[model samples]
Target: MKWLKFKILILIILMLQVEAKADGIYFGGGFYSLSAEVGNKSTSLSNPSAYSLSYTKSFFPQISFEIGYSFLFESLIGGDMSYGPQIGVRYYHYGTSTNSTASLEGLSIHEVKSYNPYLSAGFSQKEFQSIKSSYSGFYLGGGVEMGWKKNLSLFSDFKYSQLSGPVQGKANELTIIVGIIYHDF
Candidate 1:
């Protein structure tokens, strides 16, 4: 009886370990570079370094939702500054495979050993330090995520945004980001 109980305990522990690889909530932090162009000029108005923090929920195999905040401040004297909230959707292309549909019932951590790419689109509201006013915008971006360890992943993203209120002609913004995310296990 003692040996049988020990075997059952070991089996339960194995099951719990298997459950740890499932995808769910994620928290991420990253740094980005921002540049803006006015009118049809190829020259950039300002190039600033910024940072962001985000929360993400992977609801299904192909869909995930994210909300993030980014801040850009050049100096304490307020040379140029911008801060905003980004809400976006990520669509994952799992590709075609014989077992793809069955495996996607829940994506396992091992599935990300290869580079997983996704496209994202969202809305943002930014507060500009120069004008002391808020502006809303729309952005489109794409990124790739690479699995690192048990519950950590690295990602790189590039985004382009068009703001409603233009500083000079029409402000077109571009941003590139690199970050790490921790997944719920």
Candidate 2:
């Protein structure tokens, strides 16, 4: 629990420093499929869901830093609940285009593309209730974002997380998230 507190504290400090330059803030909820093996029993759940909220700031031209929390609505391995904080870096790929006006102006003007695809990888801490177990691990995922309106975009993400704890042997979760992001918030 001390480590979790420390991670949260670090994220809080970063958030405060990045708040004025935050590029976007998003909230999302989605479904997760979990497969876990403990001691002698193996279990799989296909219907549980999770909700996430995050803040992001651009650290480079194509890279952004993010911090967020994910909460599971159901238990894992008969535990009361599981949830944690996540910190990740996202890389955006922007397509290049040629503008005819560049020749006349002696300069290039690229059109602002509405579709952005990104890859994300992060570390997370999972704490389980009742069982009093805590697991820390990493996740990798990728998704796309499409502009929906001014200052708003829609995004979908799919990530896989593997965690291990003293109480629970190993747990893997596949999560799919669909959410909206508001820019410059």
Candidate 3:
């Protein structure tokens, strides 16, 4: 009876370990670059560096939701400074599996690399000559994350946004970001 109880305890511990790898919350911050176009202008104003912060929650091993904010450091054609919030969904693809679904059974917990692609939409408020205007848009982008430690990873992505309103002509913005995430396991 003692040996049987020990075996059951071991089994329960293994199951808990697998469950821990399936869900988590992560917070990250990084640098970003932005380029914006105004009116019919062929030349777009570009800022080489900006800052951003984000939070992501994983409900499954391969799926997560993210919310982020970015601060553009330089003045663009229509704005002196811009800041915004964005929300998106991320899908993780592991290894060479064409299906890209995450399976916990027999999966190694030490797996460190994955392909993550995401889609998002948000609103931005731009301040131009002391006047603030709001613009709404959607972003499409994809990125990859590489695990550095048990609960830490490094990631980068590029996104393009098409915004409407708060301007006379069509406005488009492009951004690239690189950051680190700390996951609660």
Candidate 4:
């Protein structure tokens, strides 16, 4: 019947729309904690808790790529402070990751599902007022992402960054974020 055929066509179109939505640019904001270490100083350098904004695009059904920057500042001794940015990447699948930390050297096996579990590794640095001090290192951690509604979802990750440069120290970074994704319905 004509009605039956029309319904089929509409269903197909809707499916395509959802498929497209599954992969696109996602942007949102939330809180970020910067692990303070790696700089030249005896006192611990802590960047003031701050906000972060990030962008992600799904290259495939289960695989998505993301990059973002955060700002932080903390007071040390008399009239001294530090702050800077962090960048990262991920490669994930249904509740599992082939390798969350992808780089120019390791790049392969994109996503193949709707749900993605991921790991992140990145670096951040800041300048010290006293000795041109710098804190820079890499973070290693994992996260899971779920779609709660159309173009919106919840995201969270746990990571550890090791600091080594002027002074030696270690820090733990944890983040919980809720966001309105532009894609991934």
Query: lDDT score, residue 103, model 3?
Result: 33
- Every candidate's CA RMSD: 7.5, 14.7, 6.8, 9.8
**Overall lDDT per candidate, in order of appearance:** 0.62, 0.70, 0.55, 0.49
- State the lDDT of candidate 3 residue by residue for 1-185, as single tens digits: 99766666665565443533333333333444444455665434566555567776666565667777776655432346677777876676542111111233443334344544444444443332333566666777767665566666666766677766455644567777777766543
**Per-residue lDDT of model 4, residues 1-185, tens digit only:** 99766666665554433433444343333344544444453344333343445666556655555566543334312344344556666666442222121112232212223445676666655444455666667767666666555444555555555655554554444444444444542
Q: Write the per-residue lDDT of candidate 2 for residues 42-101, one digit (tens) a residue.
A: 887765467788887777766888899887767433335678899998887752110011
Superposed model 1: Cα runs more than 4 Å off: 1-43, 46-48, 75-79, 95-112, 166-169
Give the number of the best model, judged by TM-score. 2
Q: Which pairs of residues clash in candidate 1, taking residues 3 or more apart in a chain or in different chains?
A: none
TM-score for each prediction?
A: 0.66, 0.73, 0.64, 0.54
Candidate 4's C-alpha lDDT?
A: 0.49
The Cα RMSD of model 1 versus the native structure comes to 7.5
Error of 1 at 101 (Å): 18
